[model samples]
Target: MATEERNHVSNGEGDREEQEDEKMEQFFALLRSFREARDKRKHELRLRDHEEDINKKMKKSKASKLGNDERSSWVPRFEWEDFTSEFEFPRPLVVFPTPYNKKEDQKNQEDDDGLDLNLTLSSASL
Candidate 1:
């Protein structure tokens, strides 16, 4: 009877050891899965950050290019003359926005023609 009891005790200990080993394996598997998920999320965030930075740089680069183009498209020039030999109540000298732009010159030409007709009619009446 004593020997049988010892055998049963040894078998129970072996079963406990196997249960502990299975528990440890399950814990390790769960930890590994968590680590993989964390790594994947970190990688995705990094990619998103890189993409956002690239987009921002592209926008700034394009905006700067557009600004440069617009600035180069037109440059203004001004002329000044001393106020001498002037006898008109309203100034008769015409001022233009810029002499280098032909489109503006044509637009102003129509206005000037109409204004000249009105001025001639007015001065003739006076």
Candidate 2:
């Protein structure tokens, strides 16, 4: 009877250890599932926001395209014949002088010096 009692006590302790291990496993599985659900929710929110943004951009593009189409159909307010008849030959083509020529510039400088020398000689004679 004493030997049988020892064996029964040892069996009870083993069963208790197995129960604790099973509880720990269940807790870990529940935590993992909760984290996965939270992540899925976050991903869904981001996807919805992205879809809304794309929709808004598409709407703006369509509005702008409609405005452009309307503008393209516009006709000139004046008659082509009336415009041509009233137009005068844009005042005779005014030609601007070209850049200075090196030869002409040197000739002008020499002429100026000669005039100054002649003026000095005449003044001295007086």
Which candidate gets the maximum TM-score versus the true structure?
1
- Model 1 TM-score is 0.51
Model 1 stretches with alpha carbons more than 4 Å out: 69-126
Report how far residue 121 has shifted in candidate 1, in Å: 79
**Model 2 lDDT tens row, 1-126:** 999999999999999999999999999999999999999999999999999999999999998988786667767687678867865676887899989999998998975665454445565366
Q: Over the stretch 10-114, how does candidate 1's per-residue lDDT look in tens digits?
A: 999999999999999999999999999999999999999999999999999998988776666656665454345555667567777654888888988975666
Pairs with steric clashes in candidate 2:
none
Give each model a TM-score.
Answer: 0.51, 0.48
Error of 2 at 18 (Å): 1.2
Worst 10 residues of 1 by lDDT: 115-124
Pick by lDDT: which candidate is best?
2
